[model samples]
Target chain A: MRTKRTNWLATCFLIAGSVFLLFPLYMTFMLSIKDNKEIADSVLAFPKVWRWENFITAAEKVNYWQKFKNSSIITVLTVTFTLFTNSFVAYAIKKKFDHKFFKGLYFYFISAMFVPFPIIMLPVVKLTARLGLDNLYGLILLYIVYGLSFNVLLYVGYLRSLPQELDEAAIVDGASVWQTFWKIIFPLLAPINATVAIITTVWAWNDFLLPLIMLDQESQTTLPLAQFIFQSKFGQDTNLAFASYLMAMAPLLIVYILAQKWIISGVTRGAVK
Target chain B: MKKNNFGIYLLLVLPATILFFIFHTIPAVMGIFYSFTDWNGLKPTYKMVGFINYLNVFKDKDVLDAYLFTFKFAILTTVIVNVVSLCIALALNSNIKLKNFFKGLYFMPYILSMLIVAYIFNYFFANFWIDIMGYLGIEKWMVNPLGNEKGAWLAIVFVTVWQSAAFNTVLYLAGLQTISEDLYEASALDGANKWKEFWGITFPMIAPFFTINMVLSLKGFLQVFDQVLALTGGGPFGVTRSIALLIYKNGFSGNEFAYQSANAVIYFVVIVAISLIQLRYLQKREMNL
Candidate 1:
């Protein structure tokens, strides 16, 4: 009898929580299909006419394809740069465990993690302008700066888990430090690499503040900026705005869909560790 | 072989290293320099008035509010998400059917961006749940919690907790699985009730997982920006504003460059300090497994 009551309570809690999670998604879908007139009147009611072309119209208005290309470059390059640097830095620190520089480098990198971006973002923006990198290359450099520390920490944590005998064996076999890292160490570190890449990719892709502040020039705007402009300019028109949002999310949503399993496991594992 | 290999190793790290030195480390050094100066964030032509901006930030009330508000959100969300996730975790730990599907459904929110979630919740407040309430004939409970000051803070806390609880649920569930069944058997033999068994055995076993959850949630809550920006824009009188949003707005949006840098420096110090305190407190209190 107690178990039966417990089951009922579980069902109630599960259903309520599920509804809480799903309500917004369902509303977004509903608003996308509904016109502004319908939305103003009521968002809960079923759409009398589905605006199938809302997405198409938004895509056209926002230059969705162009933004997608920009986002792809940013995410791909940022992930590659971030992961490589983080792992190398991690490897260097790990190697320096017996050397005098270990403590200094470790403290410098860890302390870097606590330096909030606001303190540095302005200086970097000015510095980027000065360096003539006030475009894609500029933004990419900004990503590397902010992204490297966390990646390094993740790599350090991961590298610590690995045995040091691998390095010793490579050193004995005429494999230099670089050869050992690239040929043997990097191959064995695939799972950690995957974790680092996926996390950094999502961070780079979803970032809005950096792009908003840095990519102020319209030609340099990423997808989020493009989507923001679309939504704000025509937010009253539920169809066009919703379409833009859906369009903006499509690439990320699709990519995440493909890697959800790995991401979920990776994220859960990260937390556990 | 040695010369070539050493060169290649450096080459392997060159692209990333150069980017980091230019973008991150250099700017960080410059920020400390700028904080001590009165260079209005943008003007290339300005005097280097030393220590004044930092002095002004110390006297600012809104900056303090931003710090307090951020701490409030972090504490409330951490407590709520952990509790709610623990309950859900326990449910799944039991003989619940459709467990995997339910887990997936719960986790769907985690993948969406905060901007999207914020707007989605705005729609929920203005339209969806109210209609559901109207349909159920309980319209009194449909008041929008995201509008008023205190109520809005609570609503954001709840929303953050709702969106994140599933992931915590997964963590605790994983933690629960690691516990030996023999512990429960031993508890049963001790004439203990289920409640007693859980508190004495179950909770202690998951203490480390609890610490992990606390830290992760604290990080997420403290850095909350997109949702607040999208939903309220820290509106209805800057009541919902967090330190991060305040820093972003002042530093970038308002162009109070020197002032904002000082603000950010203070904000960063508070987060580091509070987290250190929490860590120390938690360390002293955590039950041994």
Candidate 2:
């Protein structure tokens, strides 16, 4: 009886918490549909005349498709390259975990995690300019390097839990190191790979500063940067600005709604590690 | 075969190592070296100026303001985020139905870009909240906090805590799961109440995660950039500037490349020192627990 009452109370508390959490997003959606004039009158009211055209206007004004493409290409490339490179690095280190060189290398990479981005961002910008990598591909390369240690650590943790005898079986079957890794070990890392990929995609998609510094050309602006510039341009038009913000947020929001399970689990796993 | 294995190791590891070295390692070394020089971004010729930039960092009022604001903001957000998330985690870990739904709802904002979330909240602060508060006769909320120097820092902290509570909740939830239910049952049989049960069973068991969440949030909060940019842009005479924003403004816009590099190095040392101390303190607590 007492437990039931407490559960009911907890449910109410959670409902209230969820409402507070969802309040801003709900406001965003509401404001997106209302024209600027109505925004001042009814902060929480449904629009009498929904300005659905605001989205179209914002989309056209921002060249949303181009920016979306830039965001997509950078995020996809970063996730792909980060996953591939970090896995290899982790696998190599795992294979030779006892070797003095590999041990030192592992420690070196782990220590780098403590070095925050601002510490290195200035020199990185200068170096990018000198190398002529101040573009989308360069942004992708930087993400891979920045993401290495954390993903590699995740891979190493997962690798340790696997039975070493599985790899030995492949080795005894005359499998080359490459063949063994590709055929046996890589396939086993599917779960951790998903976790790494999802987390990296979210990060690279949302990143602003690196893209701001590196991608100097207007044509290469990512969605967040484009939204920033667009908002700055359309500062007074609340409806249009909200519309642009909605458009900037829609892709990830939709993905979260559809794949919340995968995302939540992935985030939980990543954070716990 | 041994030589082939060695070759495989080199081939597998060399790409990431080299890339990380060029981008991450070298830049860190250059950041330290450039701190002692007056190398502006556009300058072709510059000379070293031994600790002058560091001394200036102390003298510069704006830089000092940024540091003070960042440290204050970081401390406040870290404490609030941990408390809110732990409470949510505890509530969700209870026998509530639809807990998954609530968890998902809470974490929804976390997946969206901070830039976007900050912009959304920007509308609320600038217009919506003021109008509503005006109607309700709440005079204080009628003013946009982002336009006020003192209030802007609080606004940033509020948004940060709101977005991050979900993440730390998930972390604490994961930690909560690792704790066996038997301990709670034993405590309950001993006539322990909910508060006692939590203090005795829940808090100590999750000490490691507490440490992790604390350090991660502190590090992240100290380097806050996106939220400030989207919300205030260091407005109201730059009262709410974080160290990262200050570095960017000085290095790129003001052309104080080497000066900002020195500031960054100082900022970096502070971060490393704080992290080391935090880890030592928390880890010792975990061990003691």
Best by DockQ: 2
Tell me the whole-model lDDT of each prediction, alpha carbons only: 0.73, 0.87
First chain TM-score in every candidate? Answer: 0.91, 0.95
Error of 2 at A258 (Å): 1.0
Model 1: per-residue lDDT, tens digit, B129-200? 566677899856566667666667777786777667877887898788888888887778888897998889
**Model 1: CA > 4 A from native:** A1-12, A40-42, B1-21, B129-143, B253-255, B287-289
Question: How many steric overlaps does candidate 1 have?
Answer: 0
Per-residue lDDT over A143-186 for candidate 2, one digit per residue giving the tens place of the 0 to 100 score: 98888878878989889988988877777778888888888898
Best by lDDT: 2
Docking class of 2: medium
> Each prediction's DockQ?
0.41, 0.64
lDDT (Cα, tens digit) per residue for candidate 2, span B1-289: 2333766787778878988899999999999999999999788988999999999998999999999999999999999999999988888888888877887887787778888888888877886667777899999767889998768999999989888787899889889988987787778789988888788889999998999999989998999999999989988789988999999988988989999999999998999999999999999988887
Per-model chain B TM-scores are 0.87, 0.95
C-alpha displacement of B185 in model 2, angstroms? 1.3
On TM-score, the candidate that comes out on top is 2
